[model samples]
Target: MIRAQLELRIPNMTAYETITAAKKSAIPDDAAMLRAAVELTKDISAARAAIYWPDCFLSAALGYGALAGAVLLRETWLAVVCALVAALALYRALLFIHELTHIHRNALPGFRFAWNVAVGIPMLTPSFMYENVHTLHHARTRYGTAEDPEYLPLALMKPWSLPVFVAVAALAPVALLIRSAVLVPLGAVIPPLRRVVWERFSALSINPGFRRRPPEGEFGRMVFWQELGASTWAITLIASTQFIGWRPLLIALAVFSLTAVLNQLRTLVAHLWENDGEAMTVTAQYLDSVNVPPPGWLAPLWAPVGLRYHALHHLLPSLPYHALGEAHRRLSAHLGAGSTYAGAHYGGMMPLLAKIARSTMGRR
Candidate 1:
């Protein structure tokens, strides 16, 4: 029955076809049952692939490239240039990583961890920690409050101040990086910072799976290891640079930072819309996310990561990123007018920014 309920929302080739497909495929000679199983399996597989590899590899490679480029380059400006390129790589990478967390692991053991960590660790963002919070975001009654990490309360915003609001959304990734690298490190050291640390940590532990799921446990351990590894990498870079002189390190850092900033833009594009302040729930995944149907030139970045067809991704998180486009087309063909968005991109920013700014001026 639970499986049957989900089929209604799952993306398929077409609504009529989805229904027909379900009917034709239903289990137990009883078409409904067979269809339900097929749908369920597809859903699970999609989710798994989305979170794990071949799906996630492109993004991870991008992040690694940026950080590595920063470390290896000899010229300062050129190093920064490479770092920017690396950042561009990661910008695309995070998309896959974001999708990967939505997957249910049991579906395809093949693509699971390969994509998750491959894409996740390089971003210096732990897959495990992301999974915990992200899963909660899918829960009943989650958005608009402290629980919604991505939440931005309309109540807090000044009415009509579109520019400020837009600015907030645009610069959010910067805020995230600063908070992660600076605030988190400081929070760890300062006794007074315990509250913030606990709040973030509590979010991880508060979830039911945090205590019950072994995958969750593994994630926790991985977070510790990744953090240690990232720190060690930073330190090693520093030491090596001192020995060889700072040129290489400086170049690498520039490339890495550039990539990080580009990632911020793409990340913001994923969710910066204005909506009623409803709780972000599992069922609401579609609402909180956006799809990026990339142009041919951008496909190299988005196709591998599975972000180009993100709406389908929200519907099926475990499917490998590579499979997302095909799945999305199939589902989109099935759903037709039922879909809400085709998703937007950062390139649409100039007008969006201007509109928001105008909205704010009128309010003031």
Candidate 2:
């Protein structure tokens, strides 16, 4: 009966499929199921200013405080512990950039500027980098293709590619440093370099072929201030090596490097990565995304800020992170374990990582 019902209903393609030729997945269509996701989440759609403010601020505060502790503490064991705490907290704070993209412009006024001041510029990953770009990943037609900046056909790649994917992320802190300090400063004087930098280096993306359009209007103005802020901070950081010495700066980079790796690991399992550069149905995109809900306590630590429910977020992009847990509960109960909605649920990070790695090996 359930199988029969799923076949009768289906919807449009995902952000990966929003642009070009989007074909329905071979899996049975679940139009009613998709509708249920929207209907169930209606009550929780509003973003709460209270939650948004504290979560981002507190996390960034704890991260920076711990980072300072790590740099100052002389004992090896204690400093190592502080460094780990700093990395995890900062990683949580950094992931808020994802939220900034989907959130309404006026939902949390001054949030963009405050966040850039607190975490974004310091990390060299301001909201402007992701604000306009990430929406394409959720576009009705662009997902899973060369155009989807966040989508990569990783499951179909060679086994070696998986390790390389992670290794590249470890260098993110250093790469971002150069981008802010050197490239951006030079781009200010040279129009062509500015265009190339905007198109190529400005986004937080996974697909190499995904080029960003130049920011214009209000967004372009936002980019200018953010670029200036990041450059100034980056120069300050570089100058600090002369006054305070390289030890402190290097230590800070080390903490951020670990934070970057943790984020990459979380991102790896956020989806099934089985799209193969083709358009996917909305349900296919949801299924391609993985949900690590309950009984997985470790998920919150790593995939913090409702990111543990990534697949669900794809269903309701506007839903605030705080409400996702209750939303997941309601949807799971409404749909049941055997339903198409439950197909995206997974246990933990390692298993999901193993699954993706195995798929790369042709075992899937």
Candidate 3:
């Protein structure tokens, strides 16, 4: 019964059809082409792949510093300017957490800890929430299925659902604060609430029906400590509001909200979201994903931290953020314009969004 209901909700080419069609049009030997691309870029150093820690920290510092300065200034024009700068910086810094997930462990030791302390705690989006969840989205058999926690059929849903999807993110800072400050410690003491938090609040997932298994071993320990750190920071921030005056707190909230909104927009165009709740072939998944290539001067501003190459990232998940641009260049040159690789390149976000909008409206 549940399977039937889910099938009813998915409104596009069935998974089998999509996969077959994609394979027919794909490069004759995608694996070989990808291997060749990998060989071409193999010399890219892992150390260089590591997030530039100074830049990450400095960006966050400048963002928060601007926010603080804005609060002090109390001038509307200056506050708006500072708030926009802060939002862009925070968005870029927070995106490094995605890089944290893909980084080779030995390639960047202690970077995760530094990220959690500086950007994660303040933004209320600790790395633990994304760690286990994002990997599932990359899993070949799970990419477009209900099991893919990071996916939701936003492009297939009702037209009104798009704005609501992005608008909800504006409340994330407050929601995260409540989850960290109130739910974390309370759940630690109550077994039932603990289960609830673990299954629901602990993951940065979009699929409401998705449930998480309890964490165990080293990853479990990391989750526990990261949550504890976030809880501590949330409590401190909440308690300090009385003494520090609420203006700074308000400004921080504005920046955080704006950052979340920007992230929502980036995510909106990440994929075509046309899969019908079934497993997809690598080629199909690549086709479903998107890439906004060159001269989209503002692409980096909106989809920073290597997300502008999202489709290419799907092709080579292990490719470091810093190396994606180079990888894309090599692949484009080798594969030529006629390949399936060219199909994934959208040129710009506006075109992608319009395509998704048409998809959504046409279905109704």
Specify the highest-TM-score model's number.
2
RMSD values, in order shown? 9.1, 4.4, 5.8
Candidate 3 residues lying further than 4 Å off, grouped into runs, are: 1-29, 45-51
lDDT of 3: 0.79
Error of 1 at 66 (Å): 6.8
For candidate 3, write residues 1-364 as lDDT tens digits: 4334323322222222233333222312345455765687787636462347876888889888877767777789998898898899888889988877777877777888988899887788889888878989999779888899988877668888787888999998888989999998899899999999889878878788899999999999988888888899999988988899777777788788999989998998998887778776676687788888897899999999889999888887877888889888888888776565676778778887887887789666
Candidate 1, residues 50-164, lDDT tens digits: the string is 3444434655565676667667767778766666666666656655445546545565574535554565443345455466666555454653345555545332246553334
Against the true structure, candidate 1 has what lDDT?
A: 0.47
- Residue 12, candidate 3: C-alpha displacement in angstroms: 23
Choose 1 or 3, whichever is better by lDDT: 3
Order the numbered candidates by lDDT, best leading: 2, 3, 1
The TM-score values for the models, in the order shown, are: 0.60, 0.93, 0.90
Evaluate all candidate structures by whole-model CA lDDT and list the values in order.
Answer: 0.47, 0.85, 0.79
What shift in Å separates residue 153 of candidate 3 from its native position after superposition? 2.2
- Candidate 3 lands at a TM-score of 0.90
Clash count for candidate 3 is 0
- Model 3 lDDT at residue 56: 81
Predicted model with the maximum lDDT: 2
Candidate 2 CA-lDDT value: 0.85
